[model samples]
Target: MLIGAGYFFELLCTGQLKPVAGQPIFQETRFGWVVSGPADNVINSGGWAASAVNLSITENTETDLEQSITTFWKLEEYESKSVYTKEEKECESHFDNNINRDESGRFRVRLPFKKNDYKRDTQLKQDYIKCMSEYEALEHMERVDNEIENKDREGKYYIPHHAVRNDSSTTTKLRVVFDALIAEDRRDFQHVLWRPEPTQPIHVYRLNTLTYGTVPASYLATACLENLANTECDSCPEVGELIIRDFYMDDYLGGAMSKAGAIQLRDDLISIMSKAGLELRKWLSNDPELIVNVHSDNNNIRGRGQCPDSQAKILSEIATIFDPLGLFGPVIIIAKIIMQKLWQIKVNWDDVLPDNICAEWQRYRDGLPSLNNLRIPRKIISNKIVVITEIHGFVDASEKAYGACLYLRTTGVHKNIDVKLICAKSNVAPLKIVSLPRLELCAALLLSRLRNKLIPKLNLKINRRRFWTDSKVVLAWITSPSGRWKTFVAHRVCEIQELAACSEWSHVPTHDNAADV
Candidate 1:
């Protein structure tokens, strides 16, 4: 017998039953006919029973395929927050108020602690003692005994420290790092180190310079650099500007076009940093003669053996290629497409890929070694004197991907023209089917952004800037009023116009557009 409830049972029962003697009955229901009753042949065994089984299976095929594509292309959307937080503003204010220069010309800054009542934990105190003991031994710290603690002032704060050991380090294997994040406020910039032995007196040492690993350490250091630049801007403006722009934390990555210019920049850097008790070291350059006097060492580390054939391994190989400027965008786009396919198929991290994908990955992996044979010139512009300088950016798009390429076009005093590719960027198309014109517009927007970024960082003077595209539709949309079109095209056109003027955009034949490659 079949059992159900509500409308289902009513519908099943609201049918005529056609019965025949010595045969099963057939009932006509809303969902057509249903067979009922028993088998024709019965076993002659006693206490026998029959049963039936039914399964209603359902499957969901919906997937956000665009998410996988966006992830593979690293096209992340970031919400812009307030530029400065309350803590950051407080840190900046503290630096501005307490910062000073000693008679020796070295800048001095106080630690910006958030709270005054914080006390060091027992384990932290022990670590601080050990770190201070080593500091005293190295003569980097001195013991103080004359000054007594003033009850009117805030309580003393202790910064905890720990050692970080590097087995591959050649000079210092163990480095003691102070935890500035956990530091508290205090009137006196002193740390007390108690010796385990009762006979030895407690030692108090004042920290003079900016403490590393502190919450305000980076801000203080950066502020000091900026102050130094401002102080020396009247005399060495270029060096000052370089200090503000080129210095990433403590490392400087600036360069000059000519040898004499480089030597001057190096000297100015040394002089400016010396005024603030900072020294530039480990100087390295492509021109060996520039740093010939600096000692250098070579250490070769072997790479791990070939990775196993798996989805995870393919991703690992893809990440190993470091093309910061997207110079290899064309080649890398292929790998990105493969990754998108893997994501679409919902392959587990370590699961084996489909045969077709695996074969494609292996071919791409094997061809990567051939990339070493390709060499690109470091300098985009020629050494000869150039009378005219221009930046040309080309944008193109296909069904699979869209990209933009920027080239430096220079004309020498002799009217000799030279064009070299400076930078290029590409992104995989969204999985959602989009019109080709829309992708071309995206390529144009990418080109405009690329130009805006490249032009500012370039030290060379650009006489003119031009943007090229193979799509006439994109050109018309850019030249016309942005409000005339739909939201998608209009928004991109507005941004493109803001970055580059409508006149700067022009149409190029697909055959001539370098980005088409």
Candidate 2:
């Protein structure tokens, strides 16, 4: 017996919600009533005779049924905490094993052969509200106070939304391209909860304001702009694609190969996103001419582009380097390793680090400033022509962590072999640690993942793809057929074999493996 708090909140905004039997409901309602067998779902804001439910729905004049362009959530009247309804407060919170009961011992179901004609229309409207409420519930769970702000891992000049863009995408279609869900910081399915401010009472939202720095917010915002780009400006297909693909969350972490192409893309991206009511800001370009044309000097942008002051300082990380591509893999791994050691000792967020941990963390932070000098040229050889190219991957593991890296070795016009590190990944050994060989197998798997991603990301043609690993056992595991190893090694090896062939793997001395470093 539950009605969405969001729908009710919407009506409250337009002054349409009224107390019905002491239950808040709009004069015109979506879910007419889905109360219990002999009882109603809602009673009052006070203690209910049975279960209590309320919905905030707005009565709009033009009536397209109704929906919110801004917010995706509204909580149960004031369910700050979850306690069983008095009816079944003692034992367990479930109607029966057959029914889908939530932790709060509340649920609703469609009754078969319930109605036709007038009743059918009511049923359809209920379905709409139920579907919308469920979807909004999912979206709300995604954007609560929990947040993950990615530091400016790649030291680029102009980054949008700066530190917050690191939260990975949550869109259904594009979730696989970036990272995936790890362990969440808070409890799961935080349905129908929105607290705009901590000091004020917990009120439902009218605008879709998830956590400001959370992944769902950044992903949904960009996805909104991208969808708008497609539907609004179908004539400009290139602009639409760039809007969707080139962005990492809100930041445009992409570029074109030539000046004409870059300028055209830049202009189209800005114009398209702007049309969707999304403003592009902190526009940084290697081309000095391009930068001047796009950069805005005016400080006040009404929350459109750059937030007045963060115009120039977009190229550095605040705490951690989120180099998804392992350019700084080794150094970043070391920092994480130190953090792990500290965590092992059970230090809280505010606790001061021990001297050893503090020193290492400080060194890493200090070294980050030097990344400003380490420049990777934007032009993939604006001067030379490459006759041949090779993609090499290196993998290694220690007790603390395992890592992998990808390097492009190109034989250019002079037959010179120039090697450049593209991207890498470093994962800390699992808590219930496996053997070194298993960890090495994990590193190899990471290398394979990096290879699959790096190949598509790079705009180059390669003659060969190769992988190197320091561990002989991991190499044997890869070289052997899929089912030869035990469960742990077998699973990783299976993935590696699928992504990278046995012929592609080679054994290198521990010191020589770049990933080992």
Q: In lDDT terms, which candidate is top? A: 1
- Collision pairs in model 1: 180-214
Q: In model 2, which runs have C-alpha deviations exceeding 4 angstroms? A: 1-239, 274-278, 286-289, 296-320, 378-383, 431-433
lDDT of 1 at 165: 55
lDDT tens digits, residue span 1-517, model 2: 4547766655333334444455434443344432222245645677656543444344435322112201111111211236655533321222122223235322221111212333556644554455546657888424433323655446534221101122355632111122343311222322345677888687543422234444333433544555565565678876677667677777777777788888887777777666545567777665567767665433221212221122011111222244544566666666556545655777544455566655555565566656655665655433467888889989888888887778878887887777877777776786786788888887888778767755876757778998998888888889998787778888888888888779999989877877766
Alpha carbon lDDT of each predicted model: 0.77, 0.58
TM-score to native of every candidate shown: 0.64, 0.52
Q: How many clashes in each candidate?
A: 1, 11
* Model 1 whole-model lDDT (C-alpha atoms): 0.77
Best by TM-score: 1
